[model samples]
Target: MGTAGLKALLHRVRYEVLPAKSTEDKVLAHVPRDVVVTVTASPVKGLEPTLDLTARLAAHGYRVVPHVPARLLRDDRHLKEVAGRLREAGVDDVFVPAGDADPPAGGFEGALPVLRRLSELGSPFARVGVTGYPESHPLIHDDVTIQAMWDKRAYATYIVSNLCFDPRVLGEWLARIRRRDVALPVHVGVAGPVQRTKLLAMATRIGVGESTRFLAKHPAWFARFAAPGGYAPERLLTRTQEALTAPSAGVAGLHVFTFNQIAETERWRRALLDRLGG
Candidate 1:
């Protein structure tokens, strides 16, 4: 990384997880002490587990940002309880995304309702993150997604872009966000150096529809990865560097989707950073 690039990487790094059994220890063991680590709330495991994991991670001195999926919350009462738990745990940051639950859990179907409630309760968090889709979501339209982001900006401190393989798409999206004057700093999402076979196997065991939706958005990437010689994350990171170098780019940092390949991911990150003199 260049001098500016190194500074950006240091400031923007974040690790993600699904709050699986033993994930807390796994995350703590492999993730770098300096990077902000985020535990995600999956539909299967629910938010409580992730919240508890966040508290434990916070106690251990890591800056933990847990995902608060909107659909998982039952109502305002539940939201207040969740916020209180986080505040007591010294967690001052959260990532709010419209969850993937089939039926609406309560009155809130999307992030705006939950975000509004959090704001109303006088949330103690210093940073509240909202999701951004650089690629098209399977269900929601692009216009609705953009408008939802705009609507939630008042309650959000930052925007974490959903996974996108093409850096050019990210660059264009950043330009559009700036053009629209949506100034919240962006944390670009990238998957770590995971083997193609491993990724595919994991995806199958998880859910094929979800995996298909992901692959649909990045056909070129899937095709490339499925080809001979397999895939490497360096291609993605190199493109990321190019995108971040653009003048006045609001790219704040990186949110790496480690997919529980924590050790290898960190190793790849360190090696790349060293190569860039970071």
Candidate 2:
């Protein structure tokens, strides 16, 4: 498929942001008007700011999908309040993740619990997204992750994959998901063109080592990003593009991990699409 075909296939585009000093305004200013804008719930920033950011984006006429970390929600009441706030702001769609919290927050220990509660509430959202780790999760086992998705399928509308460097692994994972009958439309995650020094600095700041299991699975990527060539997301995207176009695969769109490098990412996206005549 060409660029136009690919563009036409995209239902939404997400831009993730931490609850930084000027993150909300910066993301709002840079994100395209036509696509959805998602605010990430980071361990450092917490949940309140993500909700506020999502509301702000919704006000700006973008469909906002906020990440609702399971541990951040204190209880069912808290979940209700969060859902209410999104509804009031005309925001729909959410990404539920178990989160990086050290301990469980009350009754909700993971995303499955939160998703179950959301289903019980009968919210107005047209979609609810769940995470899919194409690469190994830092802490969870592959079997456990697959089971989580199977359980979440009843509540989630789609799957947004975690960043993975290898296209073959991603494709194989997609096939596995299909075989398992967890056929939610997938949004393949890829990092946008990011500065090497900046990427490492941010990764270190975020304590990437905290997830040793994840590090163990992708030692090569860690080494590559740490080395001279650093991380270039295009090479991965190019490899995955054909897989994305495959007949049996239900790859929905690309979710660029801008890492706050929105301008560079957007430029790269446009240039590539133009080259493909999209």
Candidate 3:
């Protein structure tokens, strides 16, 4: 494939950063102001930390989007408060997920319900994102995930696929979405260059049970770590080049899971951009 398409997509790349300690410096010093920064929420720490980071990034003049896990929210009033705060923080975008919380924190049962509530309350965000599982979820059936995305189509501006190693699987899933005429543009979620250990740790933190199932299902993905240096997200992106550039695919851009390894991720991105003539 020509570098033109890859170059174009690369220019639109965004970063997803978790709220690890001193992540602010990691992002601000490494990631450029032109890139859209998406802050991720943690079930352990809840929503505030991610929102706080999003606000900090926005104040520094970057386009900021934060993930709002439905399970972390307290109530309708809490949702309204969060919306207001997000707007105040200059956040124009948000990504909602069902989350890995043990039990319901409040009324929101899932991302779909949260989307509905946001719409009902006059959504403050311009671009609201919903998750897509290109690979089957560990617990939820593939059919349910597809239906969830279809239902969320009414509210979501776009879909962000979770980190999946297999490009072929992602392509097929994207095609399936297109077949259903669920036209939400997809932002491919691929991990940036981070230690294999950190990636596994992240997986466990997100959901140990799901992580085990996920690793088991994609053994090839896990096996790669045994012999190599850290996983290179570029390889996955390159392998999915056709899917990414296909007009019918509606592959908007990339949503890189940086995992707070900002310096390395940014370096890799810039290097690729240089090679691709970005």
Name the better of 1 and 3 by lDDT: 3
Worst 10 residues of 1 by lDDT: 205-214
Candidate 2, 140: how far from true, in Å? 2.3
If scored against the real structure, what TM-score would every candidate get?
0.90, 0.89, 0.91
Question: Model 1, stretches more than 4 Å misplaced?
Answer: 1-3, 207-230
Regions more than 4 Å wrong, model 2 = 2-12, 206-220
Clash pairs detected, candidate 1: 1-276, 12-253
User: RMSD for each model, in Å, please?
Assistant: 2.7, 3.0, 2.9
* Ranking according to TM-score, highest score first: 3, 1, 2
35: Cα error in model 3, Å: 0.5
Regions of candidate 3 where Cα sits further than 4 Å from its true position:
197-223
Q: Poorest 10 consecutive residues of model 2 by lDDT?
A: 207-216
lDDT per residue as tens, model 1, 1-278 = 33567456645699887566767778778876688998877666567788888999899998999988888888888888889999999999999988776685777788888888888888678899999888877678876777778898899999998888777888888777777778898888877877777666656554222223355456676676566665676777675676665666677788887776778888888887676662
Model 2 lDDT tens row, 95-163: 888876667656677888888878778755789998999877767899789989998898999998887
Give residue 153's error in model 3 in angstroms: 0.8
TM-score for predicted model 2 compared with the true structure: 0.89
lDDT of each: 0.77, 0.73, 0.81
